[model samples]
Target: MNGPFPAIAEASATGETADLFADIRATVGVRVVNLVWRHLATLDGALPWAWAAVKPLYLGGLPDQAAQRFRETMIVPKLASLAGDAPTSVDAVLASYDHSNTINLFALGALVAWLRDEADGGPPPPHGPRLRAPDVALPVLASEADVAPETWALVQRLNRLGDTAQPLILASMYRHLARAPAFLERVEAALAPVQADGFLDRAIAANRAAAHETAKRLAQAISAQRPPLADKIETSVSAFIDHAIAKMVTICRSIRVARGQPL
Candidate 1:
């Protein structure tokens, strides 16, 4: 279906509110649930393939029709959603494309991992793969097609969210995404803002606190040590305690955010 007029669409998408993280988290939660709603209409399941075939043409390259159905079914809906009222970075990237498009590896991976975790009764997996789309086969035409304002807006929001949530996503991926590079990029990008805000400082502080606690435990272990096993026991207990504390910090990280303090 045709969307709104260009200018109106642009205006609707271009609200430059500064605090998007809170907005996005709320939006995403709602949209994700909405995607599963039975009443919502479904897009063509095979359009993903059509986008892939047409992608190169927009870039001044030729077309390839293989894998069309998959693109139509999955990729199109995902992209269209991103272009919807509540957009994400993933949506922004897809909207940059013309008719030609393909499956998003990073997004696909994250979505899969998220779904898996949801099914398993846990939070979404954090770490995964780095997302990168090279210009490998994309041949640009002589004429420049301006990306839709809505698409660009979503891109900006995604970029913003990426900046904030990347690290947490990374940590989550390591535990969940099987160490895929695409997932890692999404995690990194999503958490980009977090990195900018020096969220790592919290992680570091948490680590240091853990280390100090470990050293104290080691001292205790040494005081209680007997003869030949004293040094070994102290070292083992110290290392074990340190590792444990570091792990504990991950749990605390989210708590700070929940409390609205700087992480």
Candidate 2:
């Protein structure tokens, strides 16, 4: 199935596009532009307009606080005890996934909330306690030619983890972590039990619902500071927010299950 927009590959980016890529990574504390931004970059004037609208919120700490608030407020199931001791590598992989998921979920959630408010013709939400973005070294997105064959195959498999009908959206998380095949393998094994038991499905649904609600509240909190977005840019940003939030749900579920959490 064809996606709505093609991702602008980092290798081919130039001038403004390349600069935008760097800014996105630096601002969001990520190594690569997540699929949402990459897809936005494909649309004429969409990426810049959308970024301008949300840059202040991201930089001013609303996103980080929103994320922390989510973690503090949401009620998630407890992690099941693993049958055997996990290796240090497994722990490392889980930590990496957690970091990436937390950052994306909050930032994307805030953006979506603001977009929703804009669409609904409401005042922007008020701000919460400001917090600095976490300092974490994110893994670089691996080029296909640079990755080992087995690892690349594993990345493809991981990307399709939750598919049943439509094509599963490929998450940047897997591609970024493709550099560590062992880590992916361990994560896959750790999640196998939850996947088989249908726990992963429940977790994904829960995360998606929670994200939507969080976005709504965040939008209300930051409504007063909402920026003016053109119709074309609004439409593009809205679509990106929808897709990105859904993907973030999947990423969150995968991270939870990988850590032996229940739905």
TM-score per model over all chains: 0.22, 0.72
Q: Report the Cα lDDT for residue 81, model 2.
A: 38
The residue-level lDDT of candidate 1 at 165 comes to 26
Model 2 misplaced regions, further than 4 Å: 1-4, 73-97, 113-139, 163-165, 221-263
- Model 1 lDDT tens row, 29-116: 2211111111111222222222222222223211112112222322111110101131132222222221112212112112222222
Model 1 residue runs over 4 Å out of place are: 1-176, 179-182, 206-227, 236-248, 251-263
Q: What is the C-alpha RMSD of each candidate to the true structure, in Å?
A: 24.0, 4.9
lDDT of each: 0.25, 0.59
Model 2 lowest lDDT segment of ten: 75-84
TM-score, prediction 2: 0.72
**Candidate 2 residues 1-263, lDDT tens each?**
13655678876788888899899878776555667677777877777766766677776666666667666655343334332454444444444445545655655566665655532234444466554433445555676788998898888776655444243456666766676677677656665666677765566656656766666655544433434444545555444444444544455444555466422
